[model samples]
Target: MILAVDIGTSSMKGGLITKEGYLFSYHRVRFPLESLKGDFSFSTELWSQGFLEILETLGASKVSVVAISGNGPTMVAANAQGKPLSPALMWNSDLGDSSIHSSSYYLSKINWLRENEPQLYEKSDLFLSCPEILYTQLTGRSVMVAPQEGYIPYIWSDSELERFHFRKSAFPEIVHMGSVVAPVSENAFLKTSLKPGIPVVACGSDFIASLIGSGAMKPGRICDRAGTSEGINYCASAAIGDSRVRELPHAVKGLVNISAILSSTGSLFEWYRQLTGQEKNNYKETMDGVNAVPASQGHPFFFPSMKGENLWEFKKGLFSGLEPGQGKFELGRSVMEAIGFAVRRSLEIFEELDLPVHELRVSGGQAKSPVWNQMKADITGKTMLIPEIEDAELLGCACLAATALGIYNSVSEASEDLVKIKHEIHPRKEFSDIYDIKYRRYRRACESVVSFYRDYPVSE
Candidate 1:
């Protein structure tokens, strides 16, 4: 059996997968996000403890292989001995803001580290993601930093590393996802009830894994990831030449993956729920209420950038033209419409780049909403497909394990076998026509607000 673990934003999930592509037993444990003022982070120690507890409950004898998929773009600074210097800055955390975006910023932080916590930084050998950090903690061995496509220090080539004065020794050696990092150590055996020598495979980022798991193997196929943060990813034979598209690492060689992120999607709905004092019920009820209401003729534009935008602009959210007693359902519908519009805008960029987009595969928490799915289909004017597995990210990791175990010849072949289409949501002609207008309005709103946010200086 293969053990697949997904270290998510809010919780951790473990699944036991059989050789025949069957998911047997799954376990989920919730962990708290530590928010110290504006700095959001997660406790590495707590995560380690949680893993041990879950393994103990699973009974070590039942598991054979271990694979991990985790959130990305987040770095954990660690000492040469594999000890953490501080709480991990999660992918969602913006603690390093400018420092994360610029190499010069890192230099500044290094100076600050030297002044404030020099000893800790001195001991630190590398800044790695959760998977590398966890692997070191578990096996007392270091694994290489996987190449992430875009954002912060572009994938460091050998020359680029020299230019940046980065030490290769400080970075772990790169290993392909699903490659065995280390055998289960005596410490791991005592911490978890698992037997020794089980191979642990390092999985890729959740988004990349989800694309692989979604069976979007052929070029031009796109997947809409409507979770806490919305991501529209498409598989291409070649990397997008456009500046707007973010080129990311693909598990399969030669094929390139490009994505546009919304920075907020389900998060907007969550905010609406909290604002209306309806936090208890599922989002289905809220979406259902919106579906009952007619599409607003006025087409009140909404910019759904609740978590400071990406892809378009970095600004707080906005809802324009709110009349007194406009009804919460209208507001909710507007939010959904806004999200759909944002996706459409992203697709427009793909169109400009001449990227082929044939089918749309939808997944994540938002895929559960029929209303939202329909809206997305109409707005994009493409058939939206939902896979049999809701958590494509987890299944993607499992697919890698299947390949490593030789159950399938290749990642693409394993994806073809494991991914099954659940259903298709086709676009409604009338709804599509109406959404065309709303989408145009959304673009105009974005153009109007972008310059203001970018140029206007705010008082400190």
Candidate 2:
């Protein structure tokens, strides 16, 4: 068995998977992503504690190989002695200029650190993403696992790097995804009691791992993780060359992947629960109403705007068309409907790049809800492929490890052999027909909202 782990925005996850792709056991540890003023971050200490907790749960399994994947373009600054110098700049943190997208996001954040925290910046030894930072903890060696684009450790142009005054030395050595970074050190062995000298592979980012784990490696395939934020990722023949999508090199090597962000989806639901004093029973109670409500409720339209994506500017979340007698249930249904509509809207942008979305391989907290999944299918008019496992990201890391250990010829093949499709949810004709009318209304609502933001710029 190989141990595959990854650092997530809200938690750390991994498990032991057999060479053939069977996941034997798994574990997770959540860490606090604190907010300071308006910015968000999680420190290296929290991440380390999470990692060690996961290792402690694994109980010293003798693994053939070790690999890690993490979300990015998050920045983790480390001091010369390898201690964390600053809380990681999460992918969603706003660095004052909402103008900056993935093209120069990491550079901008690193620049912010250098300017705002010069003392910490000057003492910084490296700016590694979560994967490299976590792997370095295990091996006592550091190497930045390169992402194709959309993520940091990307192929940084010297001019672009200089534009942000990015510190070249602050970055770790670049290495290809799945490369054997180094052997595990004795110090790491003491923490977990695993044998020393195990080859550690620097698996790519978490988003790519989600694709592999869901078997969405081919072009037109999408791996959607509808959790805290909605991640809409699809494989493409080449870069769409559109800002609407964040492009990255695929784990398959030849193809590329384009990811779109919703900034809010599941989190919107959680926020509503908090507002309604239903935090403890949010899922069960809201889902009850979700099932009770049918397609095309024709209620209010909700716009989730907390985490703005590539195309739209950050604006306030809005709920329109409210009337008397429409209570929290209607609000809940509207949130669900809006989530579906927002997904379709994002896909329209993908289609503009000529990257037709074939199917959505979805996994996350939202994936457990058949009602929402059906709503998504009806709204998007595409089939939803739900994986057998809840942790596709962790499974994706397993695919990377399998590839690194020669267990599979490629990540694509590993996914095919191992990733099982539990069920496929197809679009229902009746629901689609109703959603057609509601979708048209949704389009108009979005246009109005965008126009409002344009006229009155919050300047986010």
Candidate 3:
């Protein structure tokens, strides 16, 4: 059995998986709200606590190897003994124009630390990503897991580090995904009660792991990992250059991943629930509320995101074309429809780039809703495939561990053998036609808003 764990944006999730890919047990621990304050960063100690609690809850007696994946480019500055010296600069953190290497997000954070907090930067021995820090805690080794050599520029290269005047010693040695980082150390054993000599395998960013876990290894397949934020990642043969989307190296050796991060998707739903005082409502109740209104019902056009694809400028969340008779059911349906439209806009970009997006392998919090699933399919005019395990990151970690332990020859092979789709939601022609017209209007509204913002700048 493999003890697969993922440190997510809001929580830490762990699962016990067999070589065959069956999820036997699962546990989750959400980070305290108090820890998440200021500039969208959090203390790395939350991860430390989350790991210990998850280990105790899962009780990994039969676990042979541990594999970890985490949300990143979250950078953590730590000492030689793996103790974090400062709060982790999270993936979404905005440090304006501080980067010497403008193209690399990870390097920008390092540069920000060096420029703003010289003492802390000078004291730090290693600058690691989220997963590397956790893996370091488990194995007493610090290493960066690069997906491939193609990703070196996006992360860091020796020349780029020199050009940016970053000390190479501050960065850990880069290793490939699925490589053994180190054994669970004696100190880790004393802290968490895990047996020594168990190899800790390195997995890539949570987005890559989710793609692997969703079995979207082949070109043309898209992995729509929807959680607090959403990542619509399209696997492709080569990188696409676009200002609207980012193209990064895929977990598979030669292929690339063209992705657009929807900064907020599932969080939009949560925000609606909270604002409307529907926090106590269960999933069924929430879904029921959204479902009460049929697809044909008239509702206001909702732009869910407060900020558009251009993360620098703030965008308005508008409820345009609202009718006097409309109520919460109409509003609820529109909120979900807005999410679907946001996803569709992203897919339209892939379409414009002539990338094949036959279907979306959907995973995360939003996958559980049948209405939302079908709505997404209808809006995007693509199929939605829900895997048996919606938390693909955990399963992806298991695939890495299985491959590392020689249970499978490759991560791709393990992913193929392990991933099982439980449901396939196809687009309904009637709803697709309606959504097609609505999407056009939505795009127009978005363009108008962007034009307005461009003309009358909001002072920062």
List TM-score per model, in order: 0.85, 0.87, 0.93
lDDT of 1 by residue, 225-263 (tens): 766677888888887677767776555677777888777
Residue 36 displacement in candidate 1 (angstroms): 9.2
Candidate 1 weakest lDDT stretch, 10 residues: 147-156
**lDDT for each of the candidates?**
0.69, 0.73, 0.83
Task: Report the error of model 3 at residue 62, Å.
Answer: 2.8
Of 2 and 3, which scores higher on lDDT?
3
> TM-score winner among the candidates?
3
Ranking of all candidate structures by their TM-score, best first: 3, 2, 1
Q: Candidate 3, which segments miss by more than 4 Å at Cα?
A: 37-41, 96-99, 305-314, 323-327, 451-460
Off by over 4 Å in 1: 33-40, 52-61, 79-83, 95-116, 145-170, 296-299, 305-314, 448-460
Residue-level lDDT tens digits of model 3 in 1-460: 8899998887889988888888888998977756544263588888888887888888868788999999888888998768899988888777624537366668888888888888999999999998898788778888998877777677788888888788899888999889899999988522677888899999968888999899989998889998778889998998878888987888888998889877767666766787777867787787887888887767887865335554212135667788898877688888888777778878888999998678999987788788788889999999999998889998899999888888899999999999999989999999899888888887777777666767876566
- Preferred candidate (lDDT higher): 1 or 3: 3
Query: Which lDDT value does model 2 have at 17?
Result: 79
Report the backbone clash tally of model 3. Answer: 0
TM-score, predicted candidate 2 vs. hidden true structure: 0.87
- Cα error, candidate 2, residue 22 (Å): 2.6
